[model samples]
Target: MKRLLFLLKKEFRQIIRNPFMLRAIIGVPLLQMLILVPAVTFEIKRLDLAVADNDRSPDSRELISKLTGSLFFRSAAAPLNMADAEAMLFSGDADMVLVIPDDFSEGLAGITTPRLQVLVDAVNATQAMLGWSYLTSIVRDYNREVIMARGAATSAIPGISTSPRYWYNPTLNYKYFMLPGILVILIIAIGLMLAGLNLVKELETGTLEQINVTPVRRWELIVSKVIPFFIFGLLDLALGLGVGWIAFNIPFEGSLLLFFGCSAIFLLAVLGLALFLSTLASNRQQYLFVAFFFTMVFILMSGIFTPTESMPGWAQQFNWVNPVAYLMRINRMVMLKGAGFHDIARDVGMLTVLAIAFITLAIRAYRKRA
Candidate 1:
């Protein structure tokens, strides 16, 4: 125990003495929280809309007014013809072009069904899909209003209505959804990068040879290396949470103790994985490359920016083995949904298993011989 404590002190001292690492420990979380949180968002707003008003009718003008009035769209310069509107789309000046037909008012009068033409630039598929969805919803609302007006004129009853109440997140703020996932990312990055490079750095400096000759047990050395980085991961988690609350007005709906406890287990898994990678590589550059490859795989597959449910079946199946995916789910549940241990029990169990597996591998892979 005393030997472990001494090694822990030595590791801490090494980290503290390095200025670049100290800055990275402090600055990475702050920068990612302030900059990346806002930049990495799925919400598309203020799409440019070009309208070709073939029908000078009041109803057509009203439809145009509805399109431009919403927060989703801004009206671009009116085009004289459909060709000009298509040209706007071709020139990348507009995201969507709305062509109001001549019989639009007649369709509203029940004389004919309106067939409006919508042209969208497909360069950005996500933007095009979302923009088209927004336009479709607005047109549907206008059609509903027309029906309601007719119903009132005929003294008939109104149609069925729906009032959606989003539980957990009432405002549907993207930050509320993103902050938890981003926090997980920060912890994973710090733990993985630091722990992954530790042994390689020591090997390069000939310190590993010195440590190998010491009276320190292998498990004690591994424990000492894991302890400091685990602490750093928790520190980063706290920093991210504070930033989320102060800067973004994000709420912590769950117990801080529960969140921290879960984070501790997750950090153990990440640190173990990092150390395992470290044991496989002889040099700093080799360790970095291996760590980066795994890191990219973990982040992309972890459902940080996109929903795992929406992904293909094979990808969702892979999440079962992904430590980041399990932790990401746990973080969201604990932070956003106020989940208890009962709620996240299975995920926490998986993380615990992973932590044990990784740490065991790392210990076995580490050679005491220089």
Candidate 2:
């Protein structure tokens, strides 16, 4: 116990003495929370729209007013012809082109059904789809208005009106969804990269050999190495949570103790995996490359930016072994949904098992002679 304490002190001292580590421990989480929470989002807004209005009638003008009034669109150009509208799209000045026929008002007056043409730049598939959907919804609303103005009976239109209640997030703010996932990422970055690099640094400096020859047990040494990073990980979690609450007005619906406890378990598993990987790597560069590769896989598969359900069946099955995926789910459940321990028991159990398995592997992999 005394040796473990001493080694922990030494590790803390090493981190504190290094200026870069100090800045990284304190600054990286702050910057990521401020920058990434707003930047990494799927919510599309303010799409550039080009209009080709062949009819200068009141009805056509009313339709244009409705489209321009929407928050989703900004009128980028008013082209006289389809050729000019197409040119705007080609030059990337417009996201979509709306072509209103000369007979649009006539069709509305019961002569013929009006056909509206929408040409969207499909280079960015998501933006194009979302923009097109927004335009379609606006046109549908305009059509309904025209029918009402023509004295159509309300009973003639049969449709289901859905008032969707977004339970956890009422406003559907993207930051509320992203902050918890970003917190998970910050914890992973600190625990995995720093712990792995610390071990490799010891190897590079010949300190690992010195420690190996000492009276310290391998488990004690490993525990000591992990303890410092475990504390740092929890600190980062707290820092990120505070930032989320203050900067983004994010809610914390669950117990802080419960959230912190789960985060600690996650950090242990990450740190153990790092140490185990470091043992397989003889140099810092090798460990960094290996760590980066695994980090990308873990993050991309973790359902941080996208839903795991959208992934293929085989990839979803692979998430069962992914600690990041488990933790990411736990984070949203607890922080957003106010889920209790019982709600997160299965995931917590899996993480606990992973932590134990990884720590044991790390201890066994560490050669005392080396």
Candidate 3:
């Protein structure tokens, strides 16, 4: 116990002596959270629209009015002809072009349905799909209004009206969904970078050899190293939560104690992975390359930017092994969904398994002979 405590003191003193490193440990993650939470949003907005109205009729004008009235769309300079509209699309001045036929009003009045052309720039596939959905919704509403005005006979089956209530995020604020995931990323980056670099630095500087010659047991050395980083990680997480609460107005819907408890377990797993990498790489450069490779894989496969359900079957299978994925799931579920331990039991179990696997491997690979 005395030996371990002395080693802990030595580790902390080394950390405190390097003021720049200390500041970087806390500052980098907080800065990234502030920048990325607002910048990385999935909500599509302000799509440019162009119109080529061949019919100067009331129905055509009404349709154009509806399109322009939406907050999602804005009208660009009107196109004079089909060729002109095509040119507008070619020049990237418009995301979509609305062309109303000359006989639109007559077609609406008679049995024939009015044919409207929507020329979309399908360059950005996501924006194109969302833009088409928005336009189709406007057209559907206009059609319903026209049918009601004409007193047309209703269908035998009554139409369904939907009243959607978005739980947790009523306004569908993208930040509310994104902030928790970003926090997970921040934690992992800090833990892995600091843990891997610290061990590798000792190896590079010949300090690790001196320690290896001492009376310290192998388990004692590992425990002492893990303890300080684990505490620092917890502190960083707490600071991040405070930032989220004050800056983003994020709610603390679940148990704070539970969140912290889970975070400690998750940190052990993350630090273990970093330490495991440190064991494999003999030099600082090799450790960095290995760290980056694993970190990149973890972040991309973690489903913070995209939904795992939307991924291909093989990708989803691989995501099961990703520790970051489990933590991301746990954090979001606890913070956003207000999920209890029972709800996140599966994720917790996976993390526990990962923690054991990584820490065991790291310990086994650490050679006193080396």
| Candidate with the greatest lDDT versus the true structure | 2
List where candidate 3 sits over 4 angstroms from the true fold: 56-58, 83-91, 109-112, 149-158
lDDT of 2 by residue, 1-370 (tens): 9989888889988899999998999998999999999999989898898888887789989998899899999999698688899899999999899998999888998899988899999998999999999999999998988888889996777878999998999999998898889999999999889999999999999998988888889899999989999998899889988889899989989988999999999999999999999999999999999999989999999999889999999999988878999999999999999999999999999999999999999999998766
Lowest lDDT 10-residue stretch of candidate 1: 151-160
Q: Write the per-residue lDDT of candidate 3 for residues 16-66, one digit (tens) a residue.
A: 898976897789767877898899997878778998888889988998889
Over 4 Å off in model 2, which ranges?
none
- Order the candidates by TM-score, highest first: 2, 1, 3
Candidate 1: C-alpha lDDT = 0.89
TM of each candidate vs. truth: 0.92, 0.95, 0.90
Tens digits of per-residue lDDT, candidate 1, 1-370, equal 9988888888899899999888999998999999978888889898999998887898898889999999999999988887788889999888899988888899888889888999999898999999999999999999878877777552455457799999998998898888888898898889888888887888888999998998778889888989999988899888888989899999788889999998899899888889889988989999999998988988899999889999999999988878989888988898889999999999999999999999998898889986
**C-alpha lDDT score of every prediction, in listed order:** 0.89, 0.92, 0.86
Q: Which is superior by lDDT, 1 or 3? A: 1
* lDDT comparing candidate 3 with the true structure: 0.86
